[model samples]
Target: MTNFQQSEALSRVQPSTTLAVTQKARELKAAGRDIISLGAGEPDFDTPDFIKDAAIQAIRDGKTKYTAVDGIPELKQAVATKFKRDNNLDYDLDQISIAPGGKAILYNALVATMNPGDEVIIPAPYWVSYPDMALLAGGKPVIVKADASNGFKLSPEALEAVITPKTKWLIFNSPSNPTGAAYTHNEIKALTDVLLRYPHVMVMSDDMYEHIVYDGFEFATPAEVEPALYDRTLTVNGASKAFAMTGWRIGFAGGPKPMIKAMAKVMSQSTSNPSSISQWASVAALNGDQSFLKERNDAFKERRDLVVSMLNQANGLTCATPEGAFYVYPSCEGVIGKATPNGVKISSDEDFAAALLEDEGVAIVFGAAFGLSPYFRVSYAAAIEQLEDACQRIQRFCASLT
Candidate 1:
């Protein structure tokens, strides 16, 4: 037998808990157990027909060849137009970089910029990959816990408290994953104001869920809110969540020309370019009709309401109505220290999640997986019927806790 060892960089990263829970649910269902999974951070809707048609047309046009290292010119132009039109931010084609996915885009930026011992500030509960990516890039992850009282948003004071001379980047996400808590323009301005004092710290704003806001919540990014930070901000968006094109693997960003070039250099040595067909499809997605987005937002809002209502009805769960995205992070503090019907003690969010899955076959990601605790995330991106059934099962599981 040969002895194999993982690299130190790989050892520091944890497997994605969301994907693990989703897969476990699949395995259980395959074995004839009834399962309701609310763990994936993907939209249940299909990519619009117009976008698919563009991809088909591209294939017929033989646009399947490898493209520029970062992206094709047409797609870059489309992305530039999108930034100007939707975000009120301007970017030249040379200032943009496209990669296989949003994750890849962020990873490339970190790898291109981070040095050993550099600090990356992250707010929790954050996306599962932020800290791990920083660690993989040889940067220390400085996690600042966001308070639940303020809708899981980081405060300006909290932001200031974590700043050190060695800080390199602050990874910000609006319409956040897991919690779906979007900051208002004033809230963003407050944080950007703090960032203005720390000129050494760059901002990587993930606006992946920009179009998924509810109740007319206007989305704003750091650079859009604070022009002073525009030169230091990398505004990242993609054709995944809002566009229902996750499998398309298209993500992009617009930033300073030098940073953009560096990210492209990193991509050149790794995944050279995003899929050519997907790039063309994304062009059409950005330039084509955007009316379908409103329709999808309406549907997501309804599902969010249903999940929030039913989860709050659960005996030991308290869910807050998020401003955007398809996820709801609910505190499971009420179930802690309680024993399951089978005498399994729920000492933590992980235990509660495990017991719920074992007893009711409802799968959800535990909050500790996202750098928070005594809470769990429920993605309302599933069908409304499935969400209702999952919520009911969660309620039953909570009630069964003695």
Candidate 2:
């Protein structure tokens, strides 16, 4: 027998529960169980033909060699143009760094700057990766709980209360994962006012879902909302969510030159540049026509409304209507303390999710995995028919609970 010990760094972070549940759904479906999965954080659409053609053309043109460590000059320029055209922020090529994905971009920033005992303020109901990334970087995650009452948003008061001498970064996401709650311009400015007082705290504005917003919701980033914080804010965006290019693995960000340089240094040591083909595809993605975005967003909006309406009808589930994104976070407190048909008691959010999965074969990520409990997150990124079936099963499961 051999004793194998994992590194402390490896032990600090848990496997992504979103991916875990998604994998479980796949396993069950493969085992002959009828499963409807609302667990993946990816869009259910295919990458547009234009982007795919770009990759094919790149391969045909022999553009498959390694380029710059951070990114190709063209992609960086595209990203810079995108910032100016979309976000009203001017960024030079040197201030931009590209990574394999938005998650990689975030991890690189944290790893490059974090020291032991550093703190990152992550709003609750955040994307599952935020806190774990902080932990992996040898920093403490200071979670600020922002529930339904606060529209799942961190208030200025809450933001001010959490800051300390050790606070290094504030990981901010709009149209957030799990909750799909996006902050208004005024809302973001309120928090930025607090950050202006704290010179040491930097901001990582994850705007990956910027184009997927709905109902004419104007998306605003922290740096865009407050120019005073631009020097310390890293505006991160990618083609994964918006362009339905998850497999492309292209994420880019603009920040201070020093921070961008440091992040590139980390990338140079790890996964150098993103795939050359993917980079070329991403260039087309960033620079090509964006007419398809609204069509996709319109589809997402319809699915979001359907899920919200149907989930609200489920007994004991109180769902909030989000302004953007393809997810709905519903409180499962009504289902807690109940029992399944097999007499399994549902106590925690995880328990409610497990019982639902076992009885109805509909998979969702439990809210506790997002730093909130007595709730669960449902991604409505599935097809209309699948969402209809999953919600029907959820209604049936709720009806059967004692």
Candidate 3:
């Protein structure tokens, strides 16, 4: 018998723990247990009616064939218009490429650009996929810690200390996943100034949650905020988070012509193009009325407030008020070294999350999965009642700790 070991790229990767916890909660719910899942990093709402209608119209028009390798011409044009209209950045169709999702586009770009022994700098408590994607591209992930004190943002000094001759890419996610930390324009500019000194580093700005911000916080991307970095920055955004179209699987990136071409080449070989119908849907999402964003973000802000307050009032846990996105990354340091009612010692965030799922039927991703420790991510993308119930269960579970 031959050994069927996994490929080195895949073996180096870890499954997305966010999805893993959400799936476990689904399993428990299927078994008739009362499970409250705060692990999904997606919007709870349905895709807007206009976007859905566009997809249906595309199907009715027999537009279901394979698209151009990177994207359909119209979709790419829409993406380009979206950058100019929303972010004040201009891009032509040749500099734009679309893929199955934002994750796929990022992976394709990394695979096209990364070489073996390359170092990719990622800030801690980042999206779980970033490091794994780098590893899958045969690149080393160098993590720099960003914490609650800094609003979970990486300072320029912190970033500069990590960059070396081997550094090829720097992945930035504002309105960051897991933490909901959004960087200000000045903060991004400060980091860009540091990056300017390191011309070898290409920036991949993941702006998936560009529209989900609260408290009148303006959204800004790298290329939009700093024109000098425009040539080296790949601005990645998608219809998934903002437009509530995750299953549609459409993401687009705009960058320098050469980088976009390389990413398109990678897409041509691997996944070809994003779903044709979904590409049309995403076009509608990008170019259609954006008024719904404020209402949705206001609702998210109320829920974030509710969750943050309740979580902080819990016996031992502490939570930060995130600026944007649907998640709250809270510290469980107080609970560590304590014992659960069932005698399980809570030593790490993973153990605490596991115990919470087992006892209270509330699911959240551990911070360790996101390269941070003693914290956990709770997504409040569900209804207010469900969020309240989950927080109540978490409070009760915390009360049971000794």
lDDT of 1 by residue, 1-402 (tens): 389998999999998888999999999999999998888989999999999999999999999998999999999999999999999999999999999999999999999999999999999999999999999999999999995988899999999999999999999999999799999999999999999998999999999999999998999999999999999999999999979999999999999999999999999998999999999999999999999999999999899999999998999889889999999999999989999989999999999889999999998999999989999999988888888888888888899889
TM-scores of the candidates in the order shown: 0.99, 0.99, 0.98
> On residues 1-402, what C-alpha lDDT tens digit does candidate 3 reach at each position?
498888877988898888888889999999999999999999998888999999999999999999899999999998989899889999989999999999998999999999999999999999999999999999999999998888899999999999999999999999999799999999999999999899999999999988888888889999988899999999999989999999989888999999999998888888898899998888888889999888898889999999999999998889988889999999999999999877999999999999999999999999999999999999999999999999999999999999
Poorly placed runs, candidate 2 (over 4 Å): none
Report lDDT per candidate. Answer: 0.94, 0.94, 0.92
**Candidate 2 residues 88-133, lDDT tens each?**
9999999999999999999999999999999999999889999999
Q: After superposition, how far is residue 133 of candidate 1 from its true place, in Å?
A: 0.3
Evaluation by TM-score, superior candidate among 1 and 3: 1
Q: Which residue pairs clash in candidate 1?
A: none
True-structure RMSD, every candidate: 0.8, 0.8, 1.0
Clashing pairs for predicted structure model 2, backbone only? none
